[model samples]
Target: MGQGQQEKVATSLAGTVGEEISASLAPVDAELAARYPGDPGTRQPVHTVYVPGDLLTADTVRSWGDQALAALDEHAPDAASLAAVLGLSDDLAGPVHDRVRAKLRQEPVEDLRVDFEDGYGHRADAEEDHAAARAARLVARAYADGTAPPYTGIRMKCMEAAVRDRGIRTLDVFLTGLMEAGGLPGGLVLTLPKVTYPEQVTAMVRLLDAFERAHGLAPGRIGFEIQIETSQAILAADGTATVARMIQAAEGRATGLHYGTFDYSACLGVSAAHQASDHPAADHAKAVMQVAAAGTGVRVSDGSTNVLPVGPTAQVHAAWRLHYGLTRRALARAYYQGWDMHPGHLPTRYAAVFAFYREGLAAAAARLARYAERATGDVMDEPATAKALSGYLLRGLDCGALDLAEVTGLTGLDRAGLEAFATPRRGDLTASAG
Candidate 1:
């Protein structure tokens, strides 16, 4: 085997073979690009607080924060007390406790939904209409006055025949009120609850389309969450993933798939005592939602627990432990967001979130730094892993779990660098990797 005479190897395929294959699969490629566009690289809130429509005043956000602080003052009193109640490790106790209080004083609710469905219950048409319009006015003013959460909107009733017209009227009044009060806030979010069929999602799309037209807003300017309350939303009669179809039917306006814990559990006939976010039934539903939403620019949010941290200190401690444990478990399972039904849930919510991110920050930073430098270690990583690592750190930063200086110091990557790693196109991720 002389070097100059290496078997005279030559290509067997024609030069146009690659081009022919690519041309043949062009439509498939386009479909893939359109359907699986990956995450939108926006800031996803860690939790959404649901308040009844009638209770959502302009000061509701601040009121919740104050109430959370009061709860902390009366029950926990200090970081050590909270740490004891929540069973936090010594390493995490001080920082997590302090951060929770600070967060309560500063930005308590990351996202808020004025609930017109289950939380608000059935009301007269006039009363519901007034509440909807009032919610919009107050929310708009909150935004203008710089007191609103990062995201705020309403959760309208389901598209079920019984409440379809009422839900439509509420949504119309809300959006119209926001428009009349100047304009819809950029943080506006809408939730269509108890969705069981893809056609229901299509109907929501049509409704929003009409709203945009009436207001002269751009097409696709509005997006809403599809709440998975019914078991049929997860599995259709035809044995298909109805939730996935719902996302498609949304025509690119679906921003999230929110689990409704109690309703979903009820739909499956789970016992009231066993209906929880971590229940086996809930896990199956959220798992389906997660898979359906992955790479489709749609987020999945876990449902809230009914347990409120109130009453005696012992009872409050028990409830806090439950909420914190559920939240931590959800984070481990990659469900980054959930619902907070009570102001008392805020402290434990932030505590669990802060602890989760802070506990893993150093390891994530080291791994990302190694990847950035193309260095080898015990664990092997690829572009997708890098994306995940960067995304984790970014979420931490977005939710105030980690500071910019600390993250940059540990990873040696600025915010821009992290964003670059986190948001590249799927194909480009591997294609551009060295």
Candidate 2:
């Protein structure tokens, strides 16, 4: 046969050696792809309302948010500047107020963490255990009565070397009691504070496995979150990514990485006078958290504003202003979920969250409609963008920020389209299995 016109290049290896190079790269790609922590449920709540363990009851959450509502009633601002501070577009001021009131009355606390870590401080071990067990019973009762928050859980003490045993004991007692009374509620997960090592996460996983076995629940049924309080949780002693190692150690059980305001700042040796969520150090840590947790399905939560709305009664305006300002700042940074330390923070929380959804509702809906109309458009319509847009709508509907009619009317998307948008995205299947 006559040789075809071929342009030959110099080769380092003969024959099928080139094929071996491609073959070798496949296993490395597979190993790297295996490291990803898959997506979490999109319906995660926007805030966790923490109350002292002893003080939390189903009725407390159901009926406790009236003070903030009354404050809003009395302070009907006429000035545009004040309205701006509270995130009120003149068009939404009244409806937003009504929605805030309705949200407080209907579901004041979507995620309630009966705090024993900082909100409920150190006490005698036996007394702490007793409180936890008692709280567990109340939670179980709430579950039976359908009064529990949609997401409810407890925050045990720090699980460091100093108090690991005590923390474990309290966790065991509370969970055991909860299991005996009624199994855990939907979205129930433990919160482990002061995580500085991957071993802590692994130990927690092992402990949860033990509890599930003893209680006869399915393995991996108990999930927990780690608090990124110290800088060590962001960077390990040997200079590895602490967040990555911790999630890997969780063995598919870690759901969140909650920021701790005071503890984190104090760990950095910042004085109380300068300690705030907006501080540069805090921002750096939160940025680290966001970067580490992004695409890993691990939620990142901002810490609470300790500047609570407690008053000489005259200082209510100032307190609300500060709370609202801080909330707006956090929302700007994509930390939709945060902490509410008091009942009085509820009005501002709802007000800020509603404003966030309302402010962007127009743009998001238009973009979503435009993107949905065509498979590809000028705006990127990748799986992640679609997921986020759908999730934003779902959040509004679930939290009553927008009614079904409002969402459909605005987005030009029907119920089916919204539902399809909310479904988790499956990864690309074009790559061959290695």
Candidate 3:
């Protein structure tokens, strides 16, 4: 009897809608606009070269800390320290170059990746090393205390089993403790070193999944970004497919994919010595990743420019960059994002980003127009049956060719019209996860 009366009340409420209905409807359209906003006409090209100052010393780190804390006092918030600029050869000649290294770590960079290669020094444990433990504590303290640089994450050893095992084990302890202690200051993303296959990513995902579950944290709270540093990742048939499989495996959990230009070049034996990130081969790798992840929502970032141009003067470095063709080549690549090793590279990063969006918007507008024409035809053919039209419209939306309102305007139905495309008449959308 109570159930019957409750049903009657619901029915009456549905039928008696008046001012309340109008009031609620007004907000729905407003909310829709809030959500979509007509795409901002075009998105700003991602110009972030997430610099990772991986090799900064305790004193250099301290200097940056002092600068950041001081900036917090005055007006403009200054940038974080630059990536530690260590000469690869270090075969030293006249006069020591400590001044350059000191200055590099003084300027604040967005994201700094500490390199673990030669000169970084290693742990005796091999497994639970001092370096790994030290990095964790540094990250926890920096981020936890709100003293972290603008944003930070580490590119640990890549794909080798030893590297992977060490990274996973070390990260497992470090991150677990951080999460227990209310998590790192902001967020953390581990960059897999020499990623050759999808299984490596899948393994990391599983470990992260287990770690989150064990810590009583939200499952998949931790995200990972894979580095396409090996030749395997560029193979359309093999390596690329492996990457796609990994993405599929970590469907909701993957953050982004980055091209490790130098490492990838190394895999191909492009240079007997060190393969530079700005090398032509690296450009090819960046383009390949861009093409592979085109439709996917995954963010793509290019590797850093390997060369560290000398001096503090902007003109000196600007001339060097233009002469080397490093900035333009990486900027021209399909990937909108790249890595910044030196804080001095900010100008180039900003320039390339703005240029990319300026060029992309017009092409996007044209493509969207074509998709809309096809969608209008589909809707007209079967006005009542929205499946054909809805699918096309949704596809267009995914491609950023059609905005929700524009698609709905043409179809003469709201976003709800896409329900049929997602779920058949007898098919309820919320039935089960599968």
* Alpha-carbon runs more than 4 Å astray in model 2: 1-34, 76-87, 312-314, 375-383, 422-434
Q: Rate the local accuracy (lDDT) of all candidates.
A: 0.93, 0.79, 0.50
> Which candidate do you rate higher for TM-score, 1 or 3?
1
- Where is model 1 more than 4 Å wrong at Cα? 1-9, 428-434
The sequence of per-residue lDDT tens digits that candidate 2 reaches over residues 1-434 is 35796777787767688789879999976655555535555577778988788777657776656665665556633334336556477987766777887887778888988888778887898789888998899888988888888888889877687778888888888888888896777768689999988898899998999888887889999898889999899888898879878878888788989999889999999999889889999998889888887767788899888887766555666777778788879988878788888777888788878877777787778777776775455676655576678778777777777778877887778867886776644453123212
Candidate 3 Cα outliers beyond 4 Å, as residue runs:
1-107, 114-121, 126-128, 236-240, 272-280, 311-315, 318-320, 323-325, 351-434
**TM-score of every candidate:** 0.96, 0.87, 0.56
97-162 per-residue lDDT for model 3 (tens digits)? 222232234433444454443224344445345555566667676766555555455655554666
Which residue pairs clash in candidate 1? Answer: none
- For model 3, state the Cα shift of residue 361 in Å: 11
Of the candidates numbered 2 and 3, which has the greater TM-score value? 2
lDDT of 2: 0.79
Residue 98, model 2, lDDT: 77
Of the candidates shown, which would achieve the greatest lDDT relative to the real structure?
A: 1
